[model samples]
Target: MMNHSMSAATNVMKTVIYIVCIFFAVLSIFPFWIMFMNATRGTFEIQQNSIAFFPSTHLISNFKILTGKSFNPLVGFMNSMLISSGATFCAVYFSSLTAFALVAYSWKMRQPFFTFIMAVLMIPAQVSGIGFYQFMYRIGWTNSLWPLILPAIASPAVVFFMRQYLLATLSLDVVNSARIDGSGEFATFNRIILPIMKPAMATQAIFSFVFSWNELFRPLILLTDNEKYTMPIMVSLLRGDIYKTEYGSVYLGLSLTVLPLFIIYFLLSKYIIEGVALGSIKE
Candidate 1:
């Protein structure tokens, strides 16, 4: 009788938990569903009915408006892809390398160097915005993608995350073994360390890619040409004037911008889950 009672209680608890999870999952997906629905709705329909769960019939019209004369979603998509991909690549690889150096090498000033990086991490990017822009301007990189792409190499946050991941996963004995085997430092890092860091790298790569893709301030500040504008900037431009603001088109643009991130997350979600689970256990 007691065993049956306990089994019934356990089933009840699981049912309650599943209900809560389903509720939260719906809540999380509600916004994206609304966005997609709004993308298909006309301006008047959107204005009349604020929260649409069902898609409307104006998708083609909205797309036409969004891709009309003023803004080109294709161009914005390409530019964002280039900048985000470049930044993510540099941020992950270089941060991993830096973290590896700090963790594996017992060199003089290593602690101080790590300390310096941590200190920089505490300093918000906005605080150094003026100086960075000035330096870029002086170097004649204004109106260039290089300014957006190159600074990612020194991402303090990525460095910190990589450091924690390396501390948790990397064994100095393995690194030393590779070195003792006469492997070149770069080769060892590229061939051995990189594969080991894949999960952590994938996790950070998603973050870095999303960040760069959605970033507007720096891109708006640095880029003068309309052709070089990122998706966020183009979306912002959708709200020029009250009369000109095609609400449906704006939502369509937003939906388009969000689509790539969804695809990317879907592709790398397994790694992200693994990284989180592994990192949490390590911690």
Candidate 2:
């Protein structure tokens, strides 16, 4: 009788957990659904009951007005892609090298350097936001993609993330074995460590790419030339001249911007999940 009662309780708990999970999942996805629905209907129609839940036929017409050669969204998309991709590449490369140095090598200042890096990581990069803007303006890079790409190369979060992952997944014994086999630190990292870190690096790559791609504030203030605008900047400026808001085109723009991230997450979800799990668990 006791065993049967316990079994029933366990099953009840499992069902409750499942229900809670589904509730949160729906909560998370509700915004995306709303955004998509809002994109389909005219702004006025969004307030309507039935139309709010259904797809409207204005999507194609809205898309034309959005990409209508005059307000070229493609240009912004291209710029954002270049800047984000380039930044991700550099961030991964440099951060891996730094993490390897901090982990594999024993030096007097190693702990201090790590501490400093962590401190920098703790403070929001936006603390010096004003100074950075002034400096960029002084240089010719204010109206360029360099402003978007350069700051991320020295990302503190990347450094911290790689450091934590290296400590957790990478054993000193394996690294030393590679060294004993006459491998230089850089070569060991490139051939051995990099392969092992593929999952973590992939995770970081997605984050860096998405954050950079969706970034608006930095690009908005820095780049004045319409030709050099990033995706978010272009989309934000897509507000209607005649209408107060073009709900369809705005939703379309959002969909286009988010589509790449969705594809990337879908394809590499297993790797990203593994990487995050491994990195978060301390050995």
lDDT of 1 by residue, 1-283 (tens): 9999999999999999999999999999998989889989999998898798888999999888777757788989999999999999999999999999999889999999988997887676688788888888898898789889988999988888888888888998888899899998889999999999997788888889888998988888788789888999887777777327588887888899879988977887887677556545523
Question: TM-scores, in order shown?
Answer: 0.85, 0.82
**Model 2 lDDT at residue 105:** 84
Q: Which residue pairs come into collision in candidate 1?
A: none
Q: CA lDDT of 224 in candidate 1? A: 77
Lowest lDDT 10-residue stretch of candidate 2: 43-52
lDDT score, candidate 2:
0.78
Candidate 2 clash pair list: none
lDDT of each: 0.86, 0.78
How does candidate 2 fare on TM-score? 0.82
Model 1 earns a TM-score of 0.85
